[model samples]
Target chain A: MLSESETMSRFFESWRRSIFDPDIPFRRKALDVFRHQVSHVPIYARFCDTLGIDLSAESDDDNTTGSDDDNTTGSDIDNTTGSDIDPTTGSGINPPSGPKKNPAISQYSDAAIPLMPIQVFRDLLIRPDYLTIPEAVFRSSGTSGSRQSTHEIADLTLYEESCLRGFGRFYDPEQFAVRAWLPGYSDNPNSSLVAMIDTLIRHDRSGLSRFLPLDQPMHESDFDDIREQNKRIMLFGAAFGLMDLVDSGAPALPSGSVVVETGGMKTRRREIPKQELHHRLAEGFAIPRDAVHSEYGMAEMCSQAWNNGSGWFACPPWLKITIRDPQYPMELLSPGKEGLIGVADLANVHSLSFILTQDRGVMRQDGTFQVLGRWDHAELRGCNFLMES
Target chain B: MMQSDGQITRICKAVDAWLGNESGLLEQARERTISDGLFTLHDVGHMLEQVARTVTCEAITAWVEKSRDSYAVQNSGRKDSAVYDKNVLCLHAGNLPMIGLQDIIATLLSGARYHGKLSARDPWLLDGLLRLLQKQLPENVITWSTNLDDFEELRADRILFAGSEASVEPVTSRLWELRAAGKAARFLNRTARFSIAWLSGKDVEELRNKTSGAESPGLLNDLVEAVMRYEGRGCRSVAVVVAPCELSDVAGTLIPALQDYVKKYPFLHSIKPEKSYWASYLETMDRDFFESGPIILTGDTDLMGKEDVVCWISGDAMTVQQIFEKAGPKVQSIYTVENPLPLYTEALSRAQKPPIDWKPDGVDVLRWLSG
Candidate 1:
């Protein structure tokens, strides 16, 4: 048995190895993380116990053992209390509190990757005990007097590895002078999006890459200075902040400038469709609609999927997005069909790696996907990105 | 044309008969709402049932008697009574389905011309019901419009605005402008507000046992009745459930119970609230609320305004009261198993349907309307 520190260190090493190891399939790496979490993470272990998953059968062959024949999460059970009881169907998957199945391991399956619904992070910060104190805690931006979700960074370096490496795959920070117009994030020190942008700016060393003052109105002089530099520019902004620039008659950008929006419009602006918002943004920035890009991510997951000209997002090797039926959260839907999005980010080794997001999207056969805002009842307003995008 | 008390009672009787008739006005209205995707058939049936209960001859007679007995109306010779008999405009753009019925009925009972503006969300539901009343009574008794600006053109004595705080702000300013210009118009505004239920640990335990388990069918139905009263869209709907117990314990039982309720009612699963609403739901979840079937929030209570999401906070009696007090009048109702809060709190048992005599935001609109 390994000490808590050793266990966490081993998990980190496995995560680091997966970042470069091309031979290890996504499924194998995911199962390895699942085994580590089941042994070390208390909450996850309890959840597995609820699902009747045996941790001892951690080998790849046993993944198919606990696959519930029923698609439902086994939520339907009615021990009636009142006289007025309507007929209720009980087809849900029940929590396996009965005798354990001590049989041999079965076939491998992708469903074995236990998903921590994103809302769980809001209830409790699921992190390893090795680091009681987090290096940084990224909080989601919310309306006034509302609760903000926090992600404790046990290893800030690991987060940087994911954010920077993943960002590099889409846009080169060295070639572009990064200009961020994230109002809520720029003002808030506890924003992961801001922190990621900060990392990009710090590494640039060009001095031109920095946060733009979003509190004040954008002046033409600010763009004039950027245009004079004549370097390839990458402008990152929250939806509302970008809308402000657009509404204020944003100055035309220099050639090769890319505008990437993350967080949707905050309560400040009205919600427009993605196509309309992109068209308006493209018009405001004087760039082609294809040049106006988007970043699909949240504070709950360490890895991010970037949208390169197309509305569809492409994940890196370590990250994957699975579309699940909104009605039946556990059942994965076929590609091209819209449903709730489930993210399996391997980089989130310290925290729960697989997360079922409220975000609604569709996955294509080409491995690219499109986030169609949040599922029903859950708000999908603003930029659809609840975090500092 | 002015209506007598006997005439109004006759009209109410006709309206009631129309509501109960097969494929009648009420049925048509319910169908319209269901077809428009504004509410599930069960929810529309529930709200319509409430409207039917409230629009009874007995309730209207009681309101009439109460108004006649009041000093304002008795002293018609007094200068204040001169404000009666004005064209009252009803701006019915509220989130609550069939909430416009209240203002329309109030206008009729007060013996005033009713000019109503139906919200797009409600569409033809209100108009269809009103047309039924129009068939029996004078056509000039009630008038409705889709355009809010139509209210400005019609000369009026009063304007009754119904909607969210944000929705009412523009209308209030516009009405105030009219008032400033010496238009003899008084405003009766009833904006959207959230309600909650405070369950004690003992109450929760008893319920857990009575239902045979935590996820009891009856207990799940009770919770469903509270949250899904109006698809969790109405302000009067219970947006949060507070318990004076170990939060984790409450979450343990409450999560599965709500899940069962949601699973049974699949139509509710199809709803995707506005983006702004989803953001707010996420905020509540982040704070201490866990999202199961309904968003279960446990911990200290923050202000709540979102429609679809329900919050669950755990605290002792004093702590729960403090949270309730912070909610202020924004809390329309606090459904408690018993009166556990200190005196002066408006805590009551859960109502299966809407109450005939209820003051939203605790403001006596009946007194204002009757006078």
Candidate 2:
């Protein structure tokens, strides 16, 4: 038996060790992280309570075991009457409270675990403890003044570690000059994508890494300095931003350069398919189609998933991606089955580990997942007057 | 504000005039919409057919009379009533064609100036109807902008909106941010909803007895018709089939009937690429799916809306209620033959052809306007 503080500290240590844990299975890490999150993160606990998920009776999860009572962090969790309040608008809900989550269900399988809708980040500031101020806040990129998702990072080092380790899985930062062309994100200091790229730039050691100007033309001269350093140029930009650079007639980078397309498009721009975008970027950058990689990360999670031209984002050991049934959202879909994407980012140990994203995706039999863009949702135009996007 | 008798008469006359004078006009509207890439010719044709049946003068008049009789508004409610002084902004364009037609009629009947901000997707059918109303009404009483360019500039005391809450929060959030909140009850925030076809043992028995020698089985035919129309895109299109007990024979007759209908009308009228994508995904998962002859019918209801997947689920009535109750807001309508507990929301056949006065999201347009 351990004190609540000691138990919490032990869980934290396990999460820290997981950043380097080579054999950490996603299912094992998910259950352990879920217990810790449901205890410390009040929002997540409320979400679990809303879904009626009671911890298993005969359980063994590190320092936490047996009854769900043991999983409690000695914190008071006031079940909200309706839902977590919208941080942007004083009166609005995220997904809006549906009938209390599936009744007659007590225990949840790892895949059946209730994921807090990603919109929760937009509606509420999710941090470990309500009393403690976050070390830093990460925001999602969106049209100005619009409601962008806000993620409170309790420990900035955790995000940096996830960023570095996730990147290290692919290439050594010291070998490549990490230059990023994140247009709209450059303006927002709270942008997680910018921070991830910034962390990579700092780790590059060559000091030649830089960010291309926003909405500006990037010429061949921009990367001439990096090429002079005899380092491979690892250029990172959003799909639309990279397209802008290509359309601006920016000449091809030096040979052996790797182009990474971080996903996103401005509202006004016509959206292109991921593969087509990759092909075009490859053509414009004078690189092999296989050299155009992709990185999938969002502000809500501390971990990132990367695909090295395979079109399947392989998660780091600390993160798990599950394809969930879109209709019966609580159920999980098998491999090769397309459905809504659910992510269990153990690196977000201080906030929430489980998240239900709006993006459509499918998991391969081999465990890697492919994001098939967003769900083709029928737009609701309210009141006949309800003119929604 | 209580609508004057004269205002109601004028509105009714305009609708009759539009219906009376329009010739081969429904096809024209359908062509324009199809050409605009909004819907297929078949999709628009089905919409036009529904409009012709439901939007008649009698339907509009009866709808108004019911609103005047309903409890949401008092008959002589408005003490501060002024003639045509108030303005109602009617914004539309999402799932269904001319979905905002009811609002247009209600606003005019309520004696408010109908300010329209039609989405680019708005077919000419709405404009064709509105043109007739504009002729009957006073100058400046009916003003509209086809484009959303003047969205912020447009002003009205009352508004009607029918899109999901999350969309604008995610996509419409930017537009919502550009505009400030108006007076109370400015807009009705309608969200994405789906329809269900609830069944029971009695329904199965009824289908069996009725179709013993008949070409068209009574309840089963209606269910198939309800599910097939609009290619499962309409708010009233039945996507889930619920049964109180084992769907035993009900599934037997229902699945084949659905397949037979698809065999006749194989081409997709309204193409939503996800429908086919979902069908393939279901096949790959080795889920309980039957006959993928363009119609993806599955025993598992886990994935929906991506391919108009019709999930056949069996449970007690309470269990069915719980499933719908959880998605309470999203469960738009339900159709059934036998109403054990009278659980069904509407007649199965009438799912596609909703009543002219059918209150969207259960909000009486006339009652809302009378406020």
Name the candidate that leads on TM-score.
Answer: 1
**In model 2, how large is the Cα lDDT of residue B311?**
68
**lDDT (Cα) of model 2:** 0.66
CAPRI band of model 1? incorrect
Candidate 1, DockQ to 2 decimals?
Answer: 0.04
Cα-based TM-score, every candidate: 0.57, 0.52
Q: Alpha carbon lDDT of residue A24, candidate 2?
A: 46
| Clash numbers, per candidate | 17, 22
Model 2, chain A: how large is the TM-score? 0.79
Error at A150, model 2, angstroms = 27
- Residue-wise lDDT of candidate 2 within A1-389, one digit each (tens)? 55554544444444567545665444445555565566557767666554445432322232332233332222111112111222223232222223443321223345656677676687677776522567788888756345899888866777888899988887877779988887767678998888889888787778898777765677788888888888898999988888987887757888889999888854448876677888999999999998899999988888899998787899877788988876556677999776789998878877877888978898998889988777643322122233323
Which 10 residues in a row give candidate 1 chain A its minimum summed lDDT?
A380-389
Q: What is candidate 2's CA lDDT for residue B119?
A: 66
Docking class of 2: incorrect
